[model samples]
Structures are given as structure tokens and as C-alpha cells.
Target: MTEAVSRRTPGTPCWVSLIVHGLSATQDFYGALFGWEFKPGPEQLGPYVRGRLQGEEIAGIGQLPPDRHLPIAWTTYLATDDADATAETIRSCGGTVAVGPLDAGPAGRLAIASDPNGAVFGIWQAARHAGTHLWGAPGTPVWNELITRETSSVAKFYQAVFGYEAQAVVSADFDYQTLHLDGRPVAALHGVGHALPRDRGPHWMTYFEVEDTDVAAARVVELGGHILQPPREGTSGRLATVSDPEGAAFTIVRSGER
Candidate 1:
């Protein structure tokens, strides 16, 4: 029951959203897996739906436009005071704006951008909606990370855009680091070390906390989703990466409780 009662700092991972091919099926799949409750946004919001836990907003799901063949993927958004300004920074830092700094009626202004490494994310300036209201526990998001082969350039690019400092983690086999702003861990940047299909490209990965990793991973498979990684034990407990039937990828972790 970790509820975010106030605004997050600028550059924080403020929101995560999914744009999927089938809206209804995505709703049912998450609802049954996480016990989430979904509320459709105003009519003008089209197929937008807000997913919640204990009445606090946790994430969003929207229907993919019929004419677009865009991959079903979850987006991670960073908090900003001005979305337009942030988009400018993205461009100045050698990134590209993939979408608008458009208004979501009362939800605020937002734009999607891809980093120099081609990891796509969003910038959000909160209006009536201040992004996720709850996090850091089971059934809520706990971590966000970007995996790319161009670690040095990506580090410079993000620091230029968001004032982030990448601190290397103590691992010999994995070239990974956490991004921090004002000494608070906001997200992560990891070097893709092993053989992942080249077509996957560099991308941001969203991780959700679950009560039980085995159960959750099994449930994902049961509900027409595919398990990208089998459950594995680590210092952080059991975790796995999975994709919905529509092909959006995300990870689930049970935290330190085994």
C-alpha cells in the first residue's frame, strides 16, 4: 500500500503506460493477474484506461491506433515541469521526438522521445494527473531500466538532458549502473552484455512488483502471454520477463521475500 501523495521530482520515473492492440483483453489479463481495477478515461480520451490499486492510479492502458503497425510496448515517463522544454532538451542532446507535447485534456502535456541509443520514453508535465499515485510494492511498479549497447554515449546524452549521474554497480560480468538525480535513484542504464536478438534494439524495460514470481509468471502464460525469461533467483528474489499476447514486454519481481 505504498501511495504517492504528492508530486515527484523532475526527472523521476513518474509514470508507465501501455499501448496495446486489444484494449479489452489487456484489461482482463492485468486485472486477473494483479487484481487491478481499471477506470476508463473521459470519452474524449478514446480508449484510454487508468489502472489503479486502492483507488490510487498505478498505470495506464490505451488502444493502439488501427492504422498504425506500432509494436505493443509499455512506455516509461519522466517527470518534467514543461514538456515542451524537455522535448527541446531531447533534441539538443541528439535525441528525436517521436510524438507530441500534446495535451491529454486534464491529464497534462506529454511527448515521447527516443534517446541517442534509440531507447524510447516519455516526458510528462502533470496537470490534473500527477502520474502514478502508488508504487514500490506487490502489484505496483518498483523499477525501470534501459538496456543498450552504447552505454558511454547514452550516459552523456541523458546527463545533458536530465542532469542524471550514472553510478556503476559492483558487478564484473554485467556492465550496469543506476541513474540518480539529486542523490536519489530514479532509473537505470544497463549495457546489453549477452546475445539478445539484434532486432530487439535498445529499449527501456519496466518492472512490476509481484507477490509471487512463479505464480505471476505462470499466470501470464495462462492468460495468453509469453514468458521471455524463466523465473530465476537472485539477490532481489525471483523475477522474470514476460510479454503480453500483443507483444508488450515487462518484468515481474517478488522482491526480497521468498
Candidate 2:
């Protein structure tokens, strides 16, 4: 039972954004690796920016159009009340909208889809913005992965558009697969056949909630950003992979062990 859409679970992950080709160095490399606090948005929505932490808000940063070849990512948005019937159950489960059910006036009703093994996601409908109200603490947005490669038809196209419920869980050394929704849990699809890198595509990979991922991968290499996997330790904690400084990409965890 994964398709339980009543919206407002704006707690465990509320936000996470990125869609860049260069938004003037993505607000100074995620504002010096997450002290975040950008504001100016709306010039026909080009160089957007919102992310805030101790003062609230939480995520967003935009600017896309380097020919729209798109890939400089970080995307995860789930908090739906009815984004046009969730984009018609994400196009009847095969998924692929790529932008808008529209309206972002009161900061609600957005759409930008992709699943069906392509990954990308977004579907907020909060009206006055009820997301990323500071998730898992630290710098916010704890985790949400999809890293596909067709993994079982991307888990049956997100269990038929978000009523998720996979459950595999093996032990002794990891053998993952978890994506419950009503039963809780909330993300993870991972496969990448040979551990990703055949040119990488098959996305959805966000994770921010840093306290130390090796001092945030050394302040993401002292601000020009570019780590791309460094700190390790998993089971559900210390991780890394950075990019910003005009090249989006994300991942950073420090959340208390799962």
C-alpha cells in the first residue's frame, strides 16, 4: 500500500532542490556548504534561490538552460494534496511529465516528473509552503534515493506512482530495497548494476543533513566544491559526494544511524 496521498508529511524530508547549469555558482556553493540563506526569486523564475536553515524555509535553487541538456542535479519533492491528481498518477505510472501542473504563487502546486527508471521528481501542493520545515535537523533534507538502472521497472514505477511498498531487507552485508509509504520508510531504490558510472543517468539522489561528513568534505573542498564521493561509512550515516560551484550534484549525510 504505497499510494496513500493525503499530503503534508513535511517532516522527514520536506525539501531538497537543485537544477543548475550555473546560477552564479549556486549561491556561493550552497552558501558555503549549508549555512544557506538566499532570497531573491522570480525573474520569470530563472535564478531562483530559497534555502534557509535556522531561519526556516529550507530548499530550492534554480537556473537551467545551458541548452537544457539537464544534469547537474539534486531533486526530491513529495508533499502532495493533489498536483493535478498527482499529474494523473504520474501519467498512469509509466511516468514522464517534466514540468508543472503549474502555479507557484502561494508557493504551491508544482510538478516536474520522471520516474519509470528515469528518476527526477517533484510534486508539492502545499499552498503556503509546508515543506522542508527543517528536516532531520542539521542542514536539513536527510535522505531520498532512487539511483536507478531499471531496478525492477524502477520498483514498478514507484509502486504505481507513490503508494510505495517494496521491502526486501537482507542482512549480513547489505542487500537493499526499501520504499514503504503507509508502512513508513520512504525511499531507496539503488541498483546501478556495476556501481554507477557508465556515464551516469537514472537519477534521483538527494541527501543533505550534514553535521560532519568529514567536515562536509572539507567544506566541499573549500567552497569551489567538487568532492564526488569521499567520506564513507554507510548502514545509514556518514556519506559524501558533492559538486556545486555551478555543477549541481548532491549527497551528504551525517544523520544518526538508521
Candidate 3:
């Protein structure tokens, strides 16, 4: 199993969390699916819970505030050193700061923001917690991407906010690009040339690697989750789109198919 020994690099997809109303049900769902062990997070961090794999931090879950009106979904966080500066930059870059430039106790500052096309993500400047501690295996998050039709504006907005150099990948089937930080690929932007049906809006798509995509997809359905896309083989592996009972969508990928 691969493990991360240090903090994630700035501007990379550094962390993820499920902001759900039903914390207990959400905890049980993910725990059974990913084989995660949930532990009470630091008390100063409010109702946040850290999800682990073999005792290594993998992801998190937090109770959604009743005062805030937002959908239940997995929020992806991009690493930053200055959340307040980043929030201001997000506004200046034509994006919106939907939530905070607020303290997350000693875990560092956090700010929720959305790109020009409404793809929501978080800015994290970790203090005591440096994001995911394990990766590159079953049940570990491996990639994050934004799905949108507004490729140019979205790409320009992120580059302005994060100082990323987005390089387009030439493909006959679709329009896609990769965000680079110091020449290393960090994330991707995929243009489907159409809005997502069901008013899903433009959103960040997080991928969690699994031992078997087909099996996971089936289990997701059996667990009362909905299958958005059936399992299919790709160059990298078999993948599928699925959503929790409350309609928070995510993807699963089984690696090394080819």
C-alpha cells in the first residue's frame, strides 16, 4: 500500500470530505464501501470525523450546518498556504467564495469557492492536518477533475486563482486538459460540451480507486445508491459513476486495465 509521509503540495487536490446531513448513515455507508475506520476528529474542529484506511487518514466527513443551504456531496479541497488571500483572489478571478476564509481550529484555514462555471471546491491551508495520509490503492482517492462545458473560462479562472498552467490534451473524442504545478500534473478539466442533465451543474468529480469497479458499482446500487454510469473499461481501467442515497455523485476506478 502506498502512503503519503508529508503534506500535499499547494494547488494540488489535497483533501476531500462529505458534507452530509445524516452523519451516522453517511459514516456507515462509506465505512462499509471503502473499508474505512471512522475516528472522532479534533474537538476544536467541530463535528468533523476523519476516515482512515489501515489507520492512515484517507478522507473525512463533516456535519452540514442547518443554517447553510447546500447540497450533500463530497467536496474536494485544493491545497494552499493562504486561504484568505486565495478567497480574495477567487473573487478577483470572477469566482465566488461560497463559505469561509474561516479558521478550522488548528487544522488550518478553509474557504469554499466555486469557479466561473459553478464548479465548487475548497481551499485548504492545513495546520495540524496535512490532508490524506494514504493513497494509490483500493478505497483511496486518486484523482480529482472538474466536469464542465465552459472550458476556456473555467481553465482561465483556475489558472488565475491557483497559478496553474493548464495544458490541453489533443483527443479526437473529447476536449480535456490537465492542470500542472511546476510541470507536474495535479488535476484535470473535462469538457463534455453540454450541461450535465438533472441540473447537476458544473462540478468537481472525485475518483476513488477500488479493487473492482463492477463489484463496487453493484454494491452501490444494492446499498440504495444510484448508478449514474455503468462500469466500462477505459485505457486506465474500468470505471463507473455513482451517487449516494442523497444524490452526491462520485466515481470509482479499477486501475491498470490495459
TM-score of each: 0.95, 0.31, 0.94
**What is the TM-score ranking, best to worst?**
1, 3, 2
Which residue ranges in model 1 land beyond 4 Å of their true spot?
1-4, 42-45, 170-172
Q: Residue 107 lDDT in model 1?
A: 77
Write candidate 1's Cα lDDT for 115-226 as tens digits.
9867899998998888888877677888888978847678888888888888987777777778998898889888875554376788889999998899999999999999
Query: What is the C-alpha lDDT profile of model 3 across 1-258, one tens digit per residue?
Result: 654455666798888988887778888888888898999876655687889998888888888777866777788999998899989999998999988898888777889998887888999998987888777878999889898885777898888888899999787877888999988988999888755654678889999999999999998988879899999987567899999887889999998741
Model 3 lDDT on a 0 to 1 scale = 0.85
lDDT of each residue in 75-163, candidate 2, tens digit only: 78877678888788888878888787888776677788887656677877777666666667767776787776536667876776666
Highest TM-score: give the candidate number: 1
> Where does the lowest 10-residue lDDT sum fall in candidate 2?
1-10
Best of the two (2, 3) by TM-score: 3
- The global C-alpha lDDT for each of the candidates, from Candidate 1 onward, is 0.86, 0.72, 0.85
Best by lDDT: 1
Off by over 4 Å in 2: 1-15, 18-26, 29-40, 43-47, 50-59, 62-75, 78-102, 105-108, 111-161, 172-176, 180-186, 189-205, 208-216, 220-230, 235-250, 253-258
